[model samples]
Target: MSNELPTVALVRLLEGARYEVMPTASVVDAVGEHVPPSVTVTVTAAPGKGLEATLSTATTLARAGWPVVPHLAARMLTGRGELQEVVARLAEAGVTAAFVPGGDADPPAGDYDCALDLLRDLATMEHPFTQVGITGYPESHPTIDDDVTVQAMWDKRAYATHIVSNMTFDAEHLGTWCERVRRRRVELPLLVGVPGPVERTKLLGMATKIGVGESLRFLRKQKSVFARIAAPGFSSDRFVSRVAALSANPALGIAGLHVFTFNQVGVVETWRQGMLARAREERVHPTGRGGHQDG
Candidate 1:
């Protein structure tokens, strides 16, 4: 809670943060123009755009010399054959990491029902991705129970390298969730997800375009986040600082950040740079604040 702790944590997180963007038409260009090769770029897979779009964007980014991590939605793949093809393509593109989510597809598109199922299948493949990330929900899921989500992470531990937590504005909840994950013995490091500096209207529009289910899920489960985003002069600076403070406890295994850019790569990159600069500045000249400081 000391000023030094959060200032240092914020610098660490910002230095190694990864940007997650939807596979929209302008996303590749946005990332190429705004993001550097140092920051990893993650592409999302949505039912509306299909898995192909996700792969295409990832491959393109990889080819452009960026570290790319693609989301392979379990429900999007037909079976192992399709999964194999997907892996082969990523391998060809030199992508070494991936994130697998159960996906929002209703009645699932194939053999795998959950992320665990796809992860299990991936384990059988020869030389699959070196790093696999699974979703973690800090807040209650719209459909799944809170306990079930934690258990799901436990069940997928063998197959996943880390956990990318779902975005939440509640820093308290996020900190508690990290403690809960540690308590359950899910030792995989966590990449806390947070929204980038995106406009509320733009974010909402993109969410709606992705899928009605996803939009509904966001509206229903992230009401607080929505309210925060809609507020005038909304910024993630304070939220990220609070989340970063958790890193002071090594037991939490707060790896870094996973920024949901919502395809607003330019603004997000600028915001990140500004935050990192401020954190570095604070680290050098201690403000002497005893407790945590909110943005």
Candidate 2:
């Protein structure tokens, strides 16, 4: 494929991208101030604040006219009753999408142990959500093996509408993982997870406090990931351009980007706008070089 194909694809992907924010105190205001209502915002569930934080933030965003998708952590709920209530709450708030992940809570807070368990129950209920997403790992999960993660996706395929890959910096790993998913026949469309223009110090601090086992462990294990983020001239624009070519393959099922903003909503939004503007310019002008200049 010519260089323009990926640049064109990057433009389309950025245009439809969604932002993921933690359920922080200032998140709603920050998102409201920076992100336009046209963009979809997803609220993350954390063990420290519990599910309520995610739901409340999501409801607030929804009421304010931004499309919202709340993460429903399986291990956070006590049982079916709690799940029902949560679903009812989201329905009342007009939330149309949900992303289910096996939570970080050690010892399992309730009857659910993994996302598939919660997804199974969700399938049985007349839930209000029109779209449901499950996690996909481009790199090996900190705990689960590659085969196990792939099998988990296959098992949950009946319930999930799409797959949101975990944050990854390696474009080669991402491309290989996409091929693996297709070879295994887990056909759900993917929203590639990419970190926004987050500050390294802030991101590390928040990750520690949030206590997400997978994220923290992944960070600890991959020292190079930290190095890259902490590197002087780091910009997600370069990473996105490297992987943007994969989206051109229909068989890969690359839907769009799911940007992990880490509550840096304003900065992330600025970066998104800059990238969109640049990608569009490249598309229109036909620079002939596949890659975009780092900002």
Candidate 3:
């Protein structure tokens, strides 16, 4: 294991680094300006905006020569017919990857209530998608129990190509969870969710609205979520630095860092560039002081 873990993590992070974007139209320009075409981009779905918003954003990104993965929220689709239409649209737009999430919708619009149910339907389709991603909750889920989350991962193993973990600040918790997942014999590559340089104020509001909000509520009931968010400034530095330690072990199958930019691509991109530059300087001058630099 290297004594300087972040150095190694930086390389892994930049390799096929994923930036998640929402359906907002302005995001297309923001992502184009900040995110490199080399990095994979993911489009998130919102119940209010509908799945078309996500698909259109993804299609635009794909057309712009960016590899995009759109979120297929099971609750949003009407039925298998809708799924096929979506698959066709994605195929036509050149999006070969997708992320399947159970979604936060209270009342599902279709027969597919969960991601697994959607995955089962997708398997029946002769779609063009080559890579399918499923969500993973390293920490306890907001709605589902820990055991259920684990079982869900196992159930979707056949359909999903990889697992993208939800937000978790604790590296120890993530590492331990990965170990347990391996113990269960599900060896799919795991993409750990790492937040970029997003503002605390902006995050609190958005987090409360996204699935992160539910997780926050669950954490609050357990009496551990308030302290962290209440603290003024927030950065991915500490969390990413800690997670760097896990890269030392290849058996963990930690594929790469999937950054939750939350559509704050400008700041996140600046932070990523600064980190890469810092890593380079550190390689040349190992003894120099290197503090956390997140814009």
lDDT of each: 0.85, 0.86, 0.79
Measured on C-alpha atoms, candidate 3 has an lDDT of: 0.79
What does each candidate score in C-alpha RMSD? 2.6, 2.7, 3.9
In model 1, which runs have C-alpha deviations exceeding 4 angstroms?
1-4, 208-224, 232-234, 290-295
List pairs with backbone clashes in candidate 3. none
Give the higher-lDDT candidate: 2 or 3: 2
Name the runs in model 2 displaced over 4 angstroms.
Answer: 1-4, 205-225, 232-234
Error of 2 at 282 (Å): 1.2
Q: Which portions of model 3 show Cα errors greater than 4 Å? A: 1-6, 204-235, 288-295
Clash totals for all candidate models: 0, 0, 0
Q: To one decimal, what is the Cα RMSD in angstroms of model 1 from the true structure?
A: 2.6
Candidate 2 local lDDT, 39-111, one digit each (tens): 9999988677788899999999999999999999999988788999999998998999999999877777899
C-alpha TM-score for every candidate: 0.92, 0.92, 0.87
In angstroms, give how far residue 51 of model 2 lies from its true place: 0.7
In candidate 2, which residue pairs clash? none
Q: Native-vs-model 2 lDDT?
A: 0.86
Displacement of the residue 188 alpha carbon in candidate 1, Å: 0.6
Question: How well is each residue in 169-246 modelled by candidate 3, as lDDT tens digits?
Answer: 778889999999999999999889877767656556555544564546434543333445435544466667566657
